[model samples]
Target: MEASDARVVYVHGNGNKVREDLLKSQWDTALFGADMGAATRMAYWAPLRYPAPLSDAGEDPIDGGPGGPVGFEAPDAPAAEPPDAFIARTLAEARLDATLGGAEGLVPSAPGATGDPAEAEAALGEWLRDMTYLGDTLAEGESANTVPGSDAGLEALPLPRAARTAVFRLLVEHTFKDVHGYFFGGAGPAMREVFTRALDAVAVPDGGALVVLSHSLGTIIAYEALRERPRDVDLLVTVGSPLAITEIRDILLQPPAVPAGVAAWCNASDPRDLVALDHTLRPEYAPVELVTDHLVTNDSGNHHGIREYLSTRPVRDPVRAVFDGLASGQTQ
Candidate 1:
């Protein structure tokens, strides 16, 4: 192994309205503090899926590849019923979740998973049995473990089926849209362009020492890009990610569940984060030895917020390790 300059690339999780500057500022503050300037970049794809409102009026997607921020927007498709449906579902859930105050309280996830790896695995096994998908991963006759994070601490009870279904549906919508855009929706090249730029930018004094911080749908893009495009990332951080969720996993480009050039994978989740319904990744990606799961406090009104995860020690420690490696001349 050799040491090289490490660059951080960020992929923002969810939301149509997030601005790149805002995302960059928040990530910079969280991952590197406000003062430290580092080799960090972001792979932005929100403008592809989210259209600006008429009142806010921004440039539309065009042939040179969508308008707005040069690397942001993607070609707009004909007005479809799905967007309308997504809006309706989101609004409906917003009302219901607000009323219940279940957004933060219902899912009392453990602060972190420590001690026996086998013990943590056993606990997740017990919890999944109560969920809709993935019950067979556990071996026959495993013992139940105390629920942690999003999976526990509900001084209250679980959400009703309807509320849960609404949350699930709303989330499922984002994954579906991302997959559609990244593959068939003519947005593939746009995403590839971002990866290309970041990879090139990171090749500073050396050739390719990269770090990717992908959130929500960006995780899907990063995974596919890392697999198909192939680059060197010393550390891969997924914050409030949906990669473990069955909806997205079923659609991954490669079933390896791990990217090709990543030296280490760190998965940080706030169990209370609705989008990260499936917080653990090692179970599905067991062949990989370097995946570290960090269950941290989101500290946001809504547990799934990316800023919250980015600020946690669990997330920063892994990223810092990469920079430390870079400083020591450790190469991937």
Candidate 2:
């Protein structure tokens, strides 16, 4: 696994409250090791939305500190409050706002929830996996997101308002603006800066592989960025991604698209991870030649956690292949 010339760019997803260095260090430790943090590049962009001089007091201010369960630990805390309560508290606390734009797509598509608990429950279960720490901290109640039924497909379930708002504000609002703007709205320099920085981090040697690892909404960002600006990518790994969500596909740079130079697109998601509600991108991405989807089940109660997805065979197998290719000077 001699990767001296190869590079791995990690694009983080939503609700990142820790400092970039800390987040980068944590992810590096999770993905590689203590020393590898410096080797792995982080596309730090949380500050783009929540600029410096950060504060806990504001209508939509980000709260950053060392809190909640770290990594993919199962929740053993008592379920005294409903999942929504913890979500509500997290929403109030996260304050992930869209300063330049407002809400978009699916979040508004189903404003009010439906009575059939089956679909909603299944979706909620998926979302819960992302916020398992909230599951650990809150007291259980009846109204929280608790999805039932077989986890499958691109249907818009009747998710509760609290849960809906939380997802919308944290993941949707935070990412949709940049992505949509970049493709449709003729995004300005800020978005350009993001793409610029992403490309700059690669610095892959002439024959070395470029591995782009993205989590949650970061999948959207990485996909679109690569699609618009075609480049050499040996492996594109998306964990806990929402690329299959019909709403996202609707306004993508190229509807039903894949990046030009990407050798392989490996999408991994837990069936219960609501963020990855759609689960499979093979259908929408069409032909399904280069794309492969994996059902990496999370045993740690919260399946949506990036750490859980990272630990699965889906991520490890392809990643190993890429490194092996780099070592052998061959493209798989």
Candidate 3:
């Protein structure tokens, strides 16, 4: 059960990424501080969403390459919002423009209206309350009053208020686009095929462990793929995942449970990662006793980058232990 015999398969999350080999190399370095060489493989799904790999000239914006923001940035023309009502509701809930009519369904009184002063005052009071609620939601995680299907509202993120809102919007737009594409846009089969092929490509010797590490939207892909086509996975680690979101869980293979072939499941998230707003899987996935959740501080500006998650001790330790034959029960 040496590290060399254990194989790791990584599935990336949403957004355009660098070339496949480079992406794999970056992950290897992040997890182990050196190239794992043949010990690891990546299920590269970015090409399915982005027609081309990000240029090597430091233009990669998804994971904060040289020219991009420290973390993520929305593309020049962000993908149109998907048609899902849940997504629309989340966006409307997070919108900061008060003049617009959608912020908690409160519309500002008409400009310079001669309406009754009492009515106007009541409307203003309601608007102020809604704004305060939005601020509170961001400051403290999701409020108990959050809509049933909505994501955990954005946290008191490190970025400026405006930047945080923009990032949240972008994350939502990209996440739903990718999630919707795989589940509803006929991309599921192809993406799952890529994952299955990657898993198959890794050659694990007898008694050797196979770990599946998935992030963000990739977690959804890995989960569905493994459910449809089970594999003997020693450990399934999901980071910055959206699996707990009600809408996402609803679309997953019914009667959710740990994939039959998976021995242990660990879910990790940064408290500030909007994509992984829910931060736990045990509550939703069955055989809940087998699922473990870990909270790690992701120093990356947006707090959801794969490198940040992978490098965290809480995440990397279990993977290392499994590979080293030291892991028992649930390593996390």
Candidate 4:
């Protein structure tokens, strides 16, 4: 389809705020910015809590990741020890000064930790200030950091400060796994409501196709939400997402509503991502049909971040194909 005729709605991963700037950053710096033309229209959404609720229990043991409603094989290697353990080790290795910043930042000596009460307040203040500083530093006080002059004339310009603040708080608190569930597990019910509400607010104009562009957990949310409400979506895309995870595949087909009418489903992933283990969401559940599966590999070793992939031909080619297919009416 012609780029001008397509509308893309982006649902971001867990612990996220559905804000414009972050969406632009993901597209420009990670997804569509490389050879992919910015001509395609786009928008993004996140969970209700901004940063959704979190669980530190770790990846599902069955899936070798974290626990969820899904099934999985146990992780081959012992799951890496939780960060709290590392904190314990740190406290043992390095003596913490109770009076320095007070007891807040000090690594607690054991589980269900307690700090010196006298210093707790002071330590809490210091930590809060540090967090506030980091938040402002990351975006330079903006809710999201955007790539300048990438794609112009896209609607939803000039992101709101209120939205940014809400998003900032959400992003800061995200535990990563819950972010993954935001797209899966229907994020329970409240998240689904936020998604539909946001999509409605965007209001795709008549005479143009609207595409749903999602990455990581966002892809899962898009797919499940569509299963609930399929009318507005034109195409669905998943990049560096854990939707391919075994747990999710089983849920879609097991005696429940499955994703349908997606028009075209495209999955692009880098091998380096530890979480994007698989891409096929049980081919049986697709309402439309998947086009092509691209095993694009990016240098970003970080499982969730696809910095290099977005700059390469792998991401560009498939996105361009989706655009071409939509513009030409061939994707369906």
Candidate number achieving the greatest lDDT relative to the actual structure? 3
Model 4 spans > 4 angstroms off:
1-3, 16-19, 25-47, 50-176, 179-187, 252-258, 282-284, 287-291, 306-309, 312-314, 321-332
lDDT of 4 by residue, 1-332 (tens): 23545555556554433244544554654555432334433334443444542233333221223332111121232333232332233233223232223322212233333434324333333333433233223222222211111221111111122222222222223234454344333454565555566566565546566666666656656666677776645556667666554344544523323345555555555432334544334343333234434444333313244344455453555455545655676334
Superposition error at 50 for model 3 (Å): 1.9
Q: TM-scores, in order shown?
A: 0.61, 0.63, 0.69, 0.50
Model 4 lDDT vs. the true structure?
Answer: 0.42
For model 1 the local lDDT of residue 252 reads 66
Name model 1 segments beyond 4 Å from true: 1-4, 17-19, 35-38, 50-167, 173-189, 328-332
Models ranked on lDDT: 3, 2, 1, 4
Weakest 10 consecutive residues, lDDT, candidate 2? 141-150
Candidate 3 residue 38 C-alpha distance from true site, Å: 1.2
Best by TM-score: 3
lDDT of 3: 0.64
lDDT per residue as tens, model 1, 47-141:
66667522223322210123322112223422121323323333443443233232233233233424233353344333323331221211122
Model 3, total clashes: 0
RMSD of 2: 9.1
Ranking by TM-score, best first? 3, 2, 1, 4
On the 0 to 100 scale, the lDDT of residue 248 in model 4 is 46
